[model samples]
Target: MDVLIVGAGPTGLTLGIDLARRGVEALVVERAGELFPGSRGKGIQPRTQEVFDDLGVLDAVLAASGPYPHRMIWKEGERLGEEPLFEAAAPDEGAPYTEPRMIPQWRTQEILYARLVELGGRVAFGRGVTGLTQDADGVCVEFADGTTVRARYVVAADGGRSVVRRALGVGMTGEAVDPAPFVVADVRVRGLDRNHWHAFPQDDGSALALCPLAGTDEFQLAARLPQGAAPDLSLDGVRKLVAAYSHLGAEDVTQMRWASDFRPRAALADRFRAGRVFLAGDAAHVHSPAGGQGLNTSVQDAYNLGWKLGAVLRDGARQTLLGTYEEERRANAGAMLELSTGVHRGAVRRGGATVQLGLGYRESSLSVETRTAPDGLRAGDRAPDGTVAGVRLFDAFRGPHWTLLGAATAPAAGIRALPSAPGSYGPGVFLVRPDGYVGWAGETADGLGAYLARVGL
Candidate 1:
């Protein structure tokens, strides 16, 4: 195989889909027997929605998700007030997805996995990677069953307690954003209206929140535990916690589907790559659940890496293209870590920054800006969605190819060019990369050939 991805979570599955569509020989291996069955990582930011759009899973995701509802505060069974959980923004020409959508993490993974299968990708479940050895040619991965597979490159998306990261001797350094442990569970509960997220704060410092999950009859229950208190994962324990924290009786919670306990922490790996192996998602960076940055950041990590890997393994690109995956994504992951920690500590709001629309790779080595007097969008910025020459910009840029916008002359073979729309893109020829970022910009296509050659376009 050209590439081996460990952990079939959103990160690995997303990479699988991207590589499959690019015709790269790749395989995804999961340690668990099946997909995760929890409501963890429930918020999908706008930037991630765009990524899903490119990966061809946006419709399914949108169908399964719903807009975030206002949080309804409750005091002793009496309604206090309601407030929006996220700052609202209207859609504009630059950004069509102005707000985040709420969907269970499991549903998101299912959609990605289905898309991967549709693209002729394969995933081996219950096959956990035990260790790996790398050479100049490829990486040799050993599984728990004593079987081994060799691939040109390996990606570690096995999550925070990643065995692949440990085998590579990578260390994660971070601090606990919140010292108190919390329990999150998916349960079917009665006596609660499904229109809003119900939040109940106890006299003690702990709080409980029950949010109605969209497109399902379940509710995600989250509660902060008392100091040094052990979390109960059983149905009885969930009922007790609900009764202790909220006005509803223990019997109100009818069914408990899944539950887990965790402490909110922020951590990033020392490095994202070691030889032929690369770290992604929770393996590279772990974020607090606050601000809904963890899963979104993880998905984007796979998106950043998938195309580079495909270019090197299938499109004859130089190995240097793979190096930028670490350089660009490590910095973005670090920024998201800080944002998640800040939101956890009440130092930041869950608004624009949390949406992740402003993230870009302007400082990356791959970004080439030739215009001396740049005005509007520059190289390395996200190519905004709009209509140019009667064709939607995103529609023209879709698929595994490069797009040149506003070019006076026709671009080289294999590059699609759209007539200049100075009002939207300013007076420059923009080379939009496969991942939807402007990789090169110039007054004309003078430096276009060289830039495309660098990336094997």
Candidate 2:
């Protein structure tokens, strides 16, 4: 295999789909027997929705998800007023999706896994990694069941306690984002209507929230436990928790599908790559779940690495292209870590920056701008949605290929060209990377070939 992705979470599965569509030989291995059965990472930010759009899972996600509802505060069994649960900028056509969608993390994975299979990808479940070794040529991965797989590159998406990251001797440095223990569960309840995210704030500085899960009869129960108290993850224990936090009786909680407990913390790996191996998702960074940044950031990590891996393996690009993955993602992950920690501590709001649309690789080594004083978006900015010559920008840039908007009129070699530039992009030929960021820009096609050659076009 060209690549071995350990951990079949959103990150690994997404990388699998991207690599599969690019015709790269990659395999995803998961230690878990089945997909995760929790609704922990439920909020899908707008930028991630754009990623899902290109990956062809946006429609499924939208169908299964609903808009975030207002939070209904409760005190002494009496309903207080309502407040916004999630912060979002005012709606605009800056992109197809401006607001985040509410879908269970499990459903998102299922949709991604389905798309991966549709693209002829394969995932091996119950293949736990016991150990591994790497060389200049490739990486040798050992599994718990006395089996080994070798690939040119390996991605560690197995999550925060990643065995692959440990084997590579990578250290994660972090501090607790919140001192209180937290418990999240998915349960079926009878007393709560599926309209508002019901919240019961306690005077003791702890809180409980039960939000109706989109496209399902379940509710996601998240509670901020008192400091230093251990959480009980049992179904009965969850029922008792509901009774203690709300007006609903313990018997009102009918069924518990899944549950987990954790202490919120923010951590980042010392590095994203070591030799032929790379760390992605929680393996590379772990953060507070306050602003729903953890899973979204993880998915973007895979998106950033997917096309680069394709360029190297399928298109014969230089190995140096792979090095940029660590350079770009490590910095972005660090920034997101700070943002998540801020949100956890009430230092930041859940809107604006939390959406992640403003993020780009402005300082990346690959983002070269030959044009002087280019108007509108600069090199390495996200190519926003627009239309030119009756052609939608996103539609033109959809597939596993680079798109050139502006100056160059004709498609050349492997690059897709749209000569008529949208007025918003200023006046230059912008080469959009497969991951949707403008990699190179120029007043004309000058130096375009040089940039392409550098990226192994």
Candidate 3:
């Protein structure tokens, strides 16, 4: 195998699909027999969708999920505010990408898995990485079953408490700034008839939130549990939690689909890549699930690392580019850490933005020069989206496309001569990597020359 990925979650499978599509033989191993069946990450950011577009899997995601438009805030049964979760304003078809869709985590994994299989790759289930040792040539990964496979690179997409991270002697820093127990129940609640979220602040104890799942009548009921009041998660216990936090009485709460107890925590690995072994997804960073960024961040991490790894395998680029993986993504991880902490503090102290909207990159080489603001030059930030100008072939439905963005008014040659049709990565001047991070961000036709030179394109 060119690359061996530990943990077949969204991140690992996505990396597999990207590598397989690039004709890189990548192997994915998971401890679980199949994709996780849970109501994990429910929101997908627009930038993430662009990555899917690059992988040629965005349409399946849109079909599997539905657009999630509104995100609302509440405190103790009072609706504090509601706003468009993606763009601050309405999204036009010309926009780079619109609001993200909401889909269960399992379904998202299923799509990636299918794509991976289509690319002549398959996940090795019930296989866990027990030990790994890397030398200059490659890495030898030992499975729990006492089997070993050697690959040029090994990636740990395994969740926090990653076996590869531990084997590599990497340390994670940060703690659960605000420790609280919360119950997440993903079940069919009968006849609840509630369309909006209900938040109840408990000054005496933990808070509670009822977020309505889009495209489904079932509601995701989340509530802070008293130190010892956390339920055992039996059907009756799930019913009790729903009854207490929700207006629906105990009599009204009858059925439960699934439920689990989770604690909020945040941490980051001291290093993201070491030698031929690398860490990504929750393996590299872990944070509270409050902002709905856990899986999205992980998937994005894979997107950032996948192309770089493939580049190294094919062209053997400078090791510095591989080192930059940690520099770039760890910086994003640090931002997500702060975002997660902000949400936690808001939950604990009250009053802060709980929803993560367009959290752009900072201090990257790609950012364009612009006047500094309270936040750094968000200019040259994630390229803002708009309708494809002067093209009838632009298809908004087949998104996750690389948009060749420049001043439409700026004089550049052959902009019209570029591919004027939709592609797997969508119709754009050219496709960037699967990750939203731009490999080529050109403000003019000649600007592409500068970007290509930098990346040795």
Model 1: per-residue Cα lDDT over 1-457, one tens digit each: 8999999999999999999999999999999999999989999999999999888999999999999989999999899999998999999887899889999999999999999999999899999889999999999999999999999999999999999999999999999888888999999999999999999988887999999998899999999988899999999999999998888999999999999999988999999999999999999999999899999999999999988987888778888999999899999999999999999889999999999999999999999999999997899999999988788887887888778887745556556888775377788889888889999999987888898888776
TM-scores of the candidates are: 0.98, 0.98, 0.80
After TM-score superposition, the amount by which residue 417's alpha carbon in candidate 1 deviates from its true location, in angstroms, is: 1.3
Report every candidate's CA lDDT.
Answer: 0.92, 0.91, 0.67
Please report the TM-score between candidate 2 and the true structure.
0.98
Clashing pairs in 3: 50-400, 94-386, 94-387, 95-385, 95-386, 95-387, 96-385, 96-386, 187-257
Q: RMSD in angstroms, all models?
A: 1.1, 1.1, 5.9
When 1 and 3 are scored with lDDT, the better candidate is: 1
Q: What is the lDDT of residue 19 in candidate 3?
A: 82
Model 3 TM-score relative to the real fold: 0.80
lDDT of 3 at 306: 78
